[model samples]
Target: MNYTPWDLVLDAGFLSALLIVGILLRARFKMVQAMMLPASIIAGGLGLALGPHALNVIPFSDQFGSYAGIINGVVFASLPFAGSFSFRGKLHGARKMWAYSVSTYVLQWGLGLLFAIIILGQFFDLPDGFGLLLAAGFVGGFGTAAAVGSSMEAAGWADASTLGFTSATIGVLVGVVGGLALARWGVKKGHAKLATSLAEIPQDMRTGLVPVVSKREPIGHGTTSEGTVDPLTLHIGIVAVVTAAGYGVGLGIEALWGVKVPLFATAFLTGMAMRLLLDLTPARKYVDGTTVKSISGTATDLLVAVGIASIVPSIVMSYALPLALLLAFGVVYCVLIFRFLTPRIFKDGWLERGLFTWGWATGAVATGLALLKVVDPKSKSGTIEEFGIAYVGFSPVEILMAIVAPFAIIAGLSGQFIVATIVLGIGLIFVALMGGGRADAGNRANSFSNVAP
Candidate 1:
C-alpha cells in the first residue's frame, strides 16, 4: 500500500513498452493484420506474458489492477457528451439490428446466470455472481470487465476482476481466430455477397497502415483558441470532471444506502446532467464529440493492457477447471446464438452481418467489424451503418444489464433476474419476427414493427 512517485513512472514505462511492441507487431506482420487484432489485444497479451503473473519481469505496481476501473470511468463519463441517441428515421434495417442485438444480449446474461446457479454453483465452490462473468467479459469487453470486477469486489468477490479479464481475453481470441475460419466457410458456401476469398484483402489493411489517399479527414475540429484552452484539453477536462463527480456520487450513495454502486453507471448519469447543463449555455458547441471519443479510445487501450497484465494467476489456477468449462460454453453458445437468430432477423447480408455480430457477442465490436471487412470487403452490405443507428437505442439496454445483473445475484434474486432476462430476450425475438408499422406506413400497408425494434 505504501508507494512513491517512482512506482507510478515505472508502471507507465512498462505499459507503454508493451503497447509500442503491440503496435509494431500489427504494423509489421501481415498475419496480425489479417486477423484484425487490435494493438490493445496484442499489448494486453504481451503484458500478461511479461508481468508478475507469468515471468515476473515487468515490476508492475501493486496498483496495476485498479487502473482499468479508473480509466473505464472516463469511457462511461464521455458517453453523453457525444450527443443524443437516435435512430434517424425508422430505417427498418435498424429495427432488425436492435432486435437481434438485444435478444442475444439479454439471453447471454440470462444463460450465464443459469449456468452459475444451476450448473457451476452446484459443482464448484464459487463466489456470489460468478456466472455473470461470461457476459461481463464476452459481451462487455475489458471496459465492463474492469467495472464489473470492481463492483463484485465491493460485494465480496476479490478475484472477480482477474476472472473477468481472463474471460474477455479468451472471447477476443475466439472472435479473431474462429471468425476467420468462419469467414472462409461463408465465402465457400456462396453466402458472402461481396468478398470471394480472404486472400483478396488489400495490402495496407493487411499491415494495419492506411495509405495517404485514405487520410482525408481530420479526427477533430478545434473550437477554442489555443491561448485560452486547447480543444483536446477541453474534452479531457470535461471527461475528468464527470469521472470525479461520479466518484463523489458513488461515495455519497454508499454512505447513505450501505451498498456500493457501479462507477460507470454513476459516471454516465453525471455526464448526462453535465451535458444538459452545457446545452443550456453556449459551452455545448465547444464540447467536441470526436476529441472526447479519442480520449475514450486512448483510455480504453490502456485499460485493456493493464487489465490483462494485472490478472492474479494463482486465483485463476485455483478455479481453472470450472473456469475453462464456463468459457467453453460461452464460445460455443455465442456461435449457436448467431446461427439460430440471425436468419430470423436479417433478410439481406445475413451471412456477413451474422458473422460480424458473432464477433461482437464473443468480445469486441472492432473484432466484429474486422470480420465484416473480410466478408463484405466493399462495405456494400451496410451492416455498420445499420448497427450505428441501431446502437443508439440498444445502448441503454446494455447499460441496464451491466448495472442490474450482479446486484441481483448478490441480493439472492438471481432466479428472478434470469427469468426476466430470458423472457425479455424471447419477447424481443417475437417483436423482431412479428409487428406493427411505423416506417413507410402512410405510403404502404405495413408498419416497421409489422416486419421488426
Candidate 2:
C-alpha cells in the first residue's frame, strides 16, 4: 500500500496518545515512580507491545524507521541553536572536561573493538564493524545508532542497524536504573552534596509531570499579530530549513567522495554555522533559546519512542549472546570510569560530574540532565553549565567518532582497530597527565570542599 502524508499524521497522533497514556500510568504507579522512568520509555514500551512483532493491534508502517532517522536529524540540527556555545574565559576546567569526554569515547571504542576481534571473532561469525556498536550505542545513544546504523546497513552490514538499536535500548535502561543505583551509592559514601530521601522528591517530578507552579512560561514576550507567524512556528521553521540544508550537504559530500556521512553530524555542523550566522545578523534577537530547546526535546522524545518501537525482534534475538556480553562489559566500564577516573580529573563536584558522565555515556544528554537533577536539583553543582561549555570543544570529536569511525571500520576492520587503540592510548596518557601526580591531591581536596555539605 502507498502511504500518504495522512498516514504519517495518523501514526504521530497514535504515538502522542500512547505518550499520554504512559504519563498517566507513571503518575498512578508507585513502581514507575521509584524507577523515575521517563514517559518516552514507557510510551516506547507500549509501542513495542502494540507493534507488529508483538501484537497485531497497531499497523507497523514501513516508514517508521525513516521517521526516526529524519527526526534524529532535526534533533541534532536544533542543538546549536538551543544554547550558546562559549569557549572563552574558563580554560582549565574546559580543557579537563574535554579530555574526559574524548577519553571515554576512545576507551569505549578501543575496548569494544578489542573484545570483538579477540573474543567474538574467534567464536562468532560476525562482521568486523560489530565493534563500532559499543560506542555507537553508548556514546551516541539511539539517535547516532539509528543514523550511523542506517549508513552501515547501506554499506552491506545486514544486521548492523538492528544491533545498534538493540544496544541503544539496553544502554538507556542501564543509564536510568544503574544511574539511580549509583546516585544512592554516592549518598551512602558521602560523595553527594545534597542527598534527598525518596519521600522528599516532589510528586510531579517523581511522576514525570510538570507541577502547576513549575510549568515553563511562554517563550515570546507577547502574542503575535493575527497575520504574523507565531514565534514557536518561526523557530520550528528555522529548524526545518536547517535540517533540510544539512541533508543537502550530506548528499553533496556523498556525491563528491562516494562515501556516506551520517546526516546528523552534518546537521549539527550546519546548525552551528546557522547559529554563527544568526549571531552576526540582527535576526538573532527574534530567536528564543527556550523555543529551540523545546524543539530539540520534542524531536528526541519522538526519536527514542520510535527507535525503540521499530526494533526487529528476530535480529536482536539472533545476536542475543554477543549483545549481552557487549552490554555487560559496557556497564562495568562505565562504572569504573565514574568511580575512579572522574574524581581524579574534576577539581570540584566530582560526584556531580561522575553522575553526569555516567548518564550521558550510558544514554543521552537528556539522561545526564535527568541524573543531574536527581542529585543536584538546584543545579548548584555547576556540572551542566560547565559541561555545556566543554561540549563546544568536545562536539567535533564526537562527530568524528560517530561519522568517520564507522566508515573507517567498513574500509578496513583491522586498520580501524589499530587506529582506535592508538587513540585510546593517547586518551589514557592525557587522563594521567591531567589527573595523576600533584594534581590528584589538589583535585581531591577541591572535590571534598565543594561537596562538603
lDDT of 2: 0.77
Between which residue pairs do clashes occur in model 2? Answer: none
Candidate 1: give the clashing pairs: 435-449, 435-450, 436-449, 436-450, 437-447, 437-448, 438-447, 438-448
The superposed Cα distance between candidate 1 and the true structure at residue 411, in angstroms, equals 1.7
Determine the backbone clash count of candidate 1: 8
lDDT of 2 by residue, 1-453 (tens): 898998898789888998898889889999988877778888888888898778858886768767877898998898888775665654344556666777887778778877787888888888777877887898788877877787787788878877897788888889989998898888777787665643445566787766696574664432245479877778889999999999999899999998676678778889889899989998887788888878888898898888788888888899888888878888898999898878776644588888989999988887787787777776666566567666876776676677766777777755656566567757654764455332332233344222211
Candidate 2 error regions (>4 Å): 196-198, 214-226, 253-257, 346-349, 413-453
Find the candidate with the highest lDDT and give its number. 1
Q: Residue by residue across 185-261, what tens digits does model 1's lDDT show?
A: 88898878678889776665676667677664566789899999888887888899999999999999999997788
lDDT of 1 at 160: 93
